[model samples]
Target chain A: MRKIGFSVIYFVLVSVIFILNYTFEHTAMVSYSFWNITRAVLLIFAVIVFPLLNRRIYSIAVTVLKEELRKKTLYVIFIFVALLVSLIHVFGKIAPANQHVFVGEMGLSGITLFGLLFGVFMSSTAMYKEMEKKTVYVLLSYPVSRQEIVMGKFIGNMISILLFSFLLSLIFVVSLLVRFGPINSVIVYSCFALMLEFVVIVAIATTTSTMLSSTSNIVFVIIIFLLGHMTEKITHIASRLEAQRLKEAAEVFVRVLPDFKRFEFKDALSLGTVIEPSVIIASLSYALFYSAVALIIGMLIFRRREVDRL
Target chain B: MDHVIEIKGLRKVYRDFWYRPKVIAIDRLDMEVKKGEIFGFLGPNGSGKTTALKLMLGLIFPTSGKIRILGKVPTDVRIKEQIGYMPEESYLYGFLNADETLDFYGKLNGIPRARRKERIEKVLDIVGLKHARKRRLSDYSKGMSRRISLAQVLLKDPDLVLLDEPTIGLDPVVSREVKDVILGLKSEGKTVVLSSHLLSEVQTVCDKIAILCEGKLIKEGNVDELLTVNGETEIVASGLKQEDISRIKDVISSSGGKFISSGHPKETLEGLFIKSIKEKQESKSN
Candidate 1:
């Protein structure tokens, strides 16, 4: 229903970004284009509209944040990530093309894998637990809107993931600084890129949690994450299809799905190559755009849902 | 009299996720509650008593027809400001203690800090949970959980309170206290709606009663009016011999009034319970 329309618009926009990026690469086109403008607009909305909305969502968010912290989850996952990455410093001892570079690569990869796992796990289970315990009934019995509940959980998980990301980034950044001599753009951009992925993944997990079981949501969001990074390969495979109609359908599929490959900052991160600002802005636009659309969809689905335990 | 709640042809048909009809939770039904009355919603196990309450609170939408609370639709957010709902289960977050739980709800209702503090203390005192205010709800007894949830309903001093099976799992003492609170709510001019399977307990407090059987309203009326045996009267007297009783019956017949058979009225279970506790206390003191 409404989802199909959003998919179509997203597909067209992604296709346009691909065409313009290609043109800008081959010809004398400017850097500022449709994607850049969209990024600006979305950022503006995030900066302006979210705070206004947060007035109502803040209390719920604070409670959610407390719930997250009170659980063994924060301590369990955070310690696991920190300890696992610290052990990477030992792995650098065994294989060294420059121990620092190897440590940085492995540590960044650890952050990426564990960060997504943290986001997916928290968002999926929080929704399910609330429903199973029927606590959502008491929460809804308040004057808050369903939209606020969805957004509150989203913001709450985001703030938590942000805090988690910051600590991990500090460990990664300080280690890199001590060895490599200063804070590199690669480290900064990688953290930001990983965070953008979190925004999209958390939003997707939260949305699916409204309709699907938490187990299914974890698997579903993970598959999307994997497929999202392969947009380039999928698009290439679609382009080489001999059948015309099939190729067009496949192309539509690729465009409609999110492009996580843009935020593939890990590749540049490991290789120490500079990521383009255009790509950064493009991914930022897509993250905010897709997350908003996903949350709007979640609010719609949840509003119609019966919260009664019968 | 102004109605605090109204239902006109309300029907709720629940369906499975695959779009197959599972149960007609509520068939075409209509009911109303006047302001400042304690409404008794009664039924057998599967008579949709809970379903009806959930529908009234906008927790579930009706399949057909409408429900209005205080002159606005059930789903209207503005109407929620004056309505308080407590579901069949406690459904409260176990991670929070009483103060935090009440604070979360109070903040959501946009109550200010000082006022929320004042009301929290007031409600805590009313529910008799003030001593355990710092313990998490997960650790509280079933009776304690029920009381704290009631405190949440009373926090905002809502005009219309919807309590679903408020005495479902409580001990007799706590249950009596809840009925007293319902009566107190009426004295303050607030309409209170409650559903329970314990008809005797509800009978003591309800001003109006509606009985539902299988999603249909079977009967509804004022408590006294519905239960009264019309055209008959019973007389109770002590120290009456057999000849005296026969004489009373003769007098009733001569007066053209029906005489109903009667024995001494038994004490209610709650009354007996209180009596025993008082006696035990007195004996222990002696």
Candidate 2:
């Protein structure tokens, strides 16, 4: 962690000097402080995506995903994420919304999308590919527990996402500092919260994939992500219908489903308001709770899996 | 002698998706494979040979009964250090080259780098894959992939080796090479439990044999003992004429010998192929 933190700080310092030099050469009219502010804003956006970009796993579950995604077949996904980030930069010319977007938000959103795509690939292929290809047998024959394999895979995946977000976040921050004002810290925290939401979604998707087909798992997770934000509204609608049983069931479902809206730090980003520490802690705790449950369920299903058939 | 594997009333029933027919993958199957002997497990397709292997490896849990491998429970992590397994299919990470793949498995087995390099070289040579060292597994043919899997088993140098159809799709030449590798493993004082449908291959390699069908152990014993246990005899007599051959069955029956099958003097296809190749080499030497 110290090494990672140092690298991030070093990258920011280097970007600040380079961006300042470029700003003076191109726009001699702009003041030094203005250039400094622009670099700071950009760095803030970069921070959003930074967590995903680093090449290491913070935990064990993410470590397995990191290893799996390291396979050359999955390199294309990383390229696609980089491409999307560059395209988002291009879009800044057309819409002012692009300018208001935090580098972190853009990056976290891009990584979330990439992570989901990778999650689909991970969840669908995790057991099925191993079983079909007979790799599961070799893996199972090892002294490692089945739960460890599942945990390792999940960790590897999460870590790959982190690596992507981290590196891409740095790239994004450097780009931002070159163009806009300095990045604010509030946006950084919000983006981190958003990425955690993505992790929660991935965990659920992974659990679903252990039992369902690839196509079905993707569809199911997407629906969960979509409807997850509307839990409060869904509950309200159930109450308006005046059907007590339906309302009760809807309330129950809403609690069971992740309230992704809570992790959407977009409101705080747009308003430029600092999020309360309690809010951040609460959201993080919720994500952890969901992720832990989903992982446990996935392991249970995987333990019963026969390697002979996918 | 210590038994490397012990089984009692082992059963596995799949209940999910399909109707609950209680398909017995291993039905009260009881057997023991002693240490330091090559035990051949033979059964036709869908006869639960593979299932029994899976259960023993703890890849899947048995619905009932228990299995012990290397004096520990099959799934016990401690026993994993003592057992190596080569599955029927060439299931490997296609992205990694042979060297990287071996390194990864070696790491999983807790082998250090210096010793791992020495062991990797030895096993790669054993599997005859020293030349194609840098090629990614995706580029490998089915035979090469199988050889790499075999190399992984050898790298561990475990006390017990379980091979499922070790030479299923290999050409005659490669198959013989693989057979020799298995034979070499036995000479190292390692116990091997292998499953194959090839009766002749089992006959040549195994000291003890177990025949399974429909998830049940039908027969098992020393190869020679089982053959003679039912008083069935096979004779290879070369000097008999046509009329003498006809009378030979009666002579044997009258002499209290039970004839299993009678045939002309002809070697097995595998035997003839091996013999002809050897003869050509001997003739060249002369």
Candidate 3:
């Protein structure tokens, strides 16, 4: 009954947002984008898939989720995003002709920025906090294996990040609706792609966190995030160089870094370009494969790492 | 014949970042704890009591030597189901309330929901924290946190329990209660390995003890055997006058025995504190 009550409250909150969007549509025509539809579908899929995990893994994930919820970081981010969306009128006044596009871009950018920041920060600190607080001692003393702990933290943090993405997407969607009747397909795809990118970033953060201090982990994750985003550009510039050795070195660097461009559909979204379904599928698959490899590496390192430092 | 814990030449050397040996926390030490015994591990700070406990729990890797718990390698995950460990410090998640903390650990041990709930209540009641189970650990006093830690240890009713300094930082009354709980566990035929620097506490409850100094086992034997004086004896007689005590001493001297000393027996501060508190509680109830 408590769960039902919470669900009803959530439903009512969403309905209120929808009603607000409808009311605002009279002043400015609302438009729906393909990206918006894709995000809604993806979120629904995540909601269904997360619960199917093993009980032990699911319990760990829920613990991590509860920890994050209690920290109130998610609420703070949501409130910040809410305030940012409400102030989108400033952007609209700046560019009247492309007001809706600008609004969508700002919303997507805000979600992407906040999502990446939270993902990297949370992932890097999750294991470190456990160790420093010696909470991991109690956890590791159980029958649970190291792999389960790593995987649990990853999945738990991933779900929290996804929920964050979903909330930001809703705020963006509402902002778009207020400015323009319906959101474009590009906006939805952009947000989805951003979420995929966050998955990869979180995996990197979790892996680094196994071996590095929290501060170092954050620095390393940020460096990777920047390098990942620049992989294509760096390779492109490298190919244009005269020296073959330098080009080869750049190629290795690019291959070593995560190709964040694969999921970076924001530029295309801003240009109002239609994203291919194959590209979306390929991007999602790449994110999953990369995330799996990163988590596996983290588990391997964590299994051998001595947790008796305290 | 039946050893619940066996360590053969176990050595743990912590290394620095450059792979240089930094400290030898545990030397080539060996010991065995028999089943159903409250075996006390006595050592001072930095004497490797904690290091040894961590090795036994497989929390750290041994630089050399071997440890077996329940006839399996220490690292065996399956063995942990039958083992419970309460560290020297009450290292609990501060955010979780006592109930949530127990529930979380119960889940980690893979206890079924119904059984876990039952055990949580039982353990909380045993630790006298049933009423304060909803209070966050951060809000708990040090003694309360230690009680919760002990409750979590017993939540699964493990066969082999390792308690490191269980009475450390606790009041005499609470400490006596913890000792009684250990005795209770012993009564149930559970094998307990307790480590503490409190000789008095260890003396009262430990059936056998191993004392370590500078990472070496300096002494090992039954508490009574190790503490018994070969040529002297202690006599306690209440309601005896000073003349009666003098007469008893003269009789000992006449029996070809040297009279060492004779005086009123002194009660340990812990014992006195416990008695006072118990009396106060009884009077309050009455």
Candidate 4:
């Protein structure tokens, strides 16, 4: 608890400094404070927070990672993805403006595809499979709470997603550097945005999975993902409609559903939107806050659920 | 003596899609099990014995009632730290070895690494799975799988243990070993609550028993007191048996009573159970 309290305090302190830096973009002191805050947050996470995470959650996370790691197919999947990207690079030679742009676009797409797959599939099955196999009976019989189980599984899936993203990102970036000689700095932001997007995707899947089966959960979350991308359009339609009832309903949905357009790093880049610091902060905070809410809701539902029924 | 478990007016009614009462899995029932006693939970299929155990573990919510285990509500995770539960089926993760499974459970209980290792060895030894500790559960025989499950349950050295059909599918040797383990737990001052359909097994280990019928407690008492026949007597004779038997017959004739045939000195629990049920039905019809 002390560890968590310390971490939260440090995080808020750093985030305040970071926002202040953005607000006073021209101030030398604020920029220096921003650098120090960034470094301190990274160091705190690596040195203090990682080791201080709840032991039960960490153990569960490791078990999940080990289970997926032992499957031995992740390597094949990565290789398969890299080969597809290489093929894309080959197609780039048919002569558009520059091959690097095409390669970067295709590479980022591959990362997003794999990361989403990792997040969605693992979240759906992590807890469901434990219950299906009745392995949960023993685990639940221990001193662990339903919240810890849900959080542990969520963290497990997140770690798995992180590793998959990193490996694929490496493959994409390495392939780009070798083939195109230079790469854009915008790709870093794109990867970060993709990861944040997955955080929401995985949390939504985790939340729905408590009540739904694996297949239904996957189907439901896929529909949610699709609808999330179209929330902007839905909001516009809600405003310009004559039917007050439907408009109210659409407005409710727009308020409830996550506006995925917030994480549209690629769109912002392509349109030369300058990627303001406040925009980046807003997207980051939205993704985190949304994921946290989804997880809490999942825990509450799972807390009330009967494991025997599961 | 403190009651290790106290359940009052416990009812669990599983609902349907429309939020209507569907099946009353456990009707209003009350039970108390004391510390250091092997409490047997006996019932036929679908009689709510398993449902009762699940309720004690807080795996399911009771419709209306209270359950306190180890002086705390079942849902409290602190009570779980002191309770060990083993379900009927020992189906665990097929991908894990016995050590890995026990280690995972130990970590869940927040046991330190060094103590967990020591406790793991002790439990593996108890379940007689020390030799197969490194073997993956998927490759284990049914008995081995069950033993490993038992080992996991004992990993935390819990104060109260709940076993649902602990020896259902095992051979006689293994079943006997499990019964012995239950007895050993009693010897160690730990409370054991076991649910089983095997009357003979329950009769052997249980000091007190509860007979549940269709989600209601039909009978509950000390095993010896419940099984003892009220108006029956038996005498064992050794030398001059024929002469003694003839004299007993003559005495019986003089007393205007017929002697009942007897082979073994003690009546089987199975026979008592059937007789009890028949008398119950006859009384209900009357």
Off by over 4 Å in 1: A1-53, A276-281, B236-250, B253-262, B278-286
Clashes of each: 0, 44, 20, 0
User: Which tens-of-lDDT digit does each residue in B1-286 have in candidate 4?
Assistant: 3999999999999988798988998998999999999999999999999999999988888899999989988878777888998889886777778889888889888899999999998988888998988888889999998898888778878889999999999876678788888998999999999999999899999999999989999999999999999887667765656677788878987998778873446676545665776788899999
Better of 1 and 4 by TM-score: 1
TM-score of chain B of each: 0.93, 0.85, 0.94, 0.87
Deviation from native of the Cα of residue A33 in model 4, angstroms: 9.6
By DockQ rank, best first, the candidates go: 1, 4, 3, 2
Q: What ranking emerges by lDDT with the best candidate at the front?
A: 3, 1, 4, 2
TM, every model: 0.89, 0.78, 0.89, 0.86
User: What level of docking quality does candidate 1 show?
Assistant: medium
Question: Which residue segments of model 4 deviate by more than 4 Å?
Answer: A1-52, A72-75, A268-282, B236-258, B262-286
Please tell me the TM-score of chain B in candidate 3 relative to the true structure's chain B: 0.94
Runs in model 3 lying further than 4 Å from the true structure: A1-52, A241-246, B238-247
Collision pairs in model 4: none
Could you give candidate 1's per-residue lDDT for residues A1-120 as a string of tens digits?
Answer: 122332234334445545655676577666566648755465535522543354557887888888878988668878888877756777877766767667777887888877788888
